[model samples]
Target: MSIAISTALQSSFADAVTRTREALAGQGFGVLTEIDMKATLKAKLDQDMENYLILGACNPPLAHRAVDIDRQIGLLLPCNVVVRTDPDDDTRVLVEAMNPQLLVQVTGDPALQEVADEVTAKLRAAIQALGPTSG
Candidate 1:
């Protein structure tokens, strides 16, 4: 399975980030944390990079269900969604979300299958809501 559910949009990086947040919220996810990778790296390592933001999104009900099935699941809690400018094309931006199904694969737990499938569906819907994917 693909590691991330993603889409490439022909949009400004700022616009892409706004739309991504709206999409995730529409799917019942809230951003618990936001990390501006570009800023952080520049300040810490004096390294420059394309505009990049990492959103730690969570759907509480689904997260609770998964955690109930396995306590250690918190390690993977709060799905990561990345909105960044495409390195090769300044006008193109990429939005990507972690594939929840990986949790079932990594944990090798059949019990998580239902929750994983549900989360995967919600995540896919959110990504699709952004707009037509160029790639």
Candidate 2:
């Protein structure tokens, strides 16, 4: 299975990020953390890269369910969603959500499968709500 659910956005990178945040919030997900990869790389390695941001998103209810199924699941809590400017075309942005099904596999628990499916659906909806690509 694909590791991520991704979509191309017609909007600018900033707008895509905002839209992603809003979409995720609509699905009961809150961004718990954000990492600006470009800035971090530039600061630490003196290497410039395309605009890229990673949003650590979590849906409390689903997270609680997963943890209830397996306490160790906290290691996978807060799914990651990445928004970045396409390297070949700065006008376009790409957004991808970490696939939650991996959690079921990692936990080796069939009980968590339902939780993973639900989370995956929510994440896919958020990405779809971003609309179509620029070109």
Candidate 3:
């Protein structure tokens, strides 16, 4: 299975990032952490890259359910969503979200399948909300 669900939007990098966060919130997810990859790479490695962001998103109830199913599931508690400029075309932005089903594979627990399916559905909805170009 694909590790992530992705889409391309014809929007400014900054606008795509903002819209993505809003979309996640509409689906009952909250941003728990934000990683500015461009800034990090420049500061730590002196490498310049496109505007890229990583939003650590979590739906509390789902997270709690998964954790209750398997304590070690915390390792994948928050789903990561990334927004970045298309290297070949700066006018377009790419957004990709983690696939929760991977949790079932990692934990070998059938119980997690439901939670994964639910989370995946929500994440997919959030991405689709971006518009016709979204996947």
Best by lDDT: 1
| Stretch of 10 with least lDDT, candidate 3 | 126-135
Compared with the true structure, what per-residue lDDT tens digits does model 2 show for residues 1-135? 788888997788888999999999999999999999999999999999999999999999999998998999998878999999999988889998999998987778999999999999999888888875221
- TM-score per prediction, in order, is 0.97, 0.94, 0.96
What lDDT, from 0 to 1, does candidate 2 have? 0.90
38-117, model 3: which lDDT tens digit per residue? Answer: 99999999999999999999999999999999999998868999999988998889999998989999789999999999
| Residue 27 displacement in candidate 1 (angstroms) | 0.6
Error of 2 at 125 (Å): 0.9
Task: Report, for every candidate in turn, its global Cα lDDT versus the true structure.
Answer: 0.93, 0.90, 0.92
| lDDT by residue for model 1 (1-135), tens | 888999999888999999999999999999999999999999999999999999999999999999999999999988999999999999999999999999999999999999999998998999999876422
TM-score of 2: 0.94
Model 3, C-alpha of 50: deviation from truth (Å): 0.6
Candidate 2 weakest ten by summed lDDT: 126-135
Choose 1 or 2, whichever is better by TM-score. Answer: 1
By TM-score, highest first, what's the ranking?
1, 3, 2
- True-vs-predicted CA distance for residue 41, candidate 1, Å: 0.3
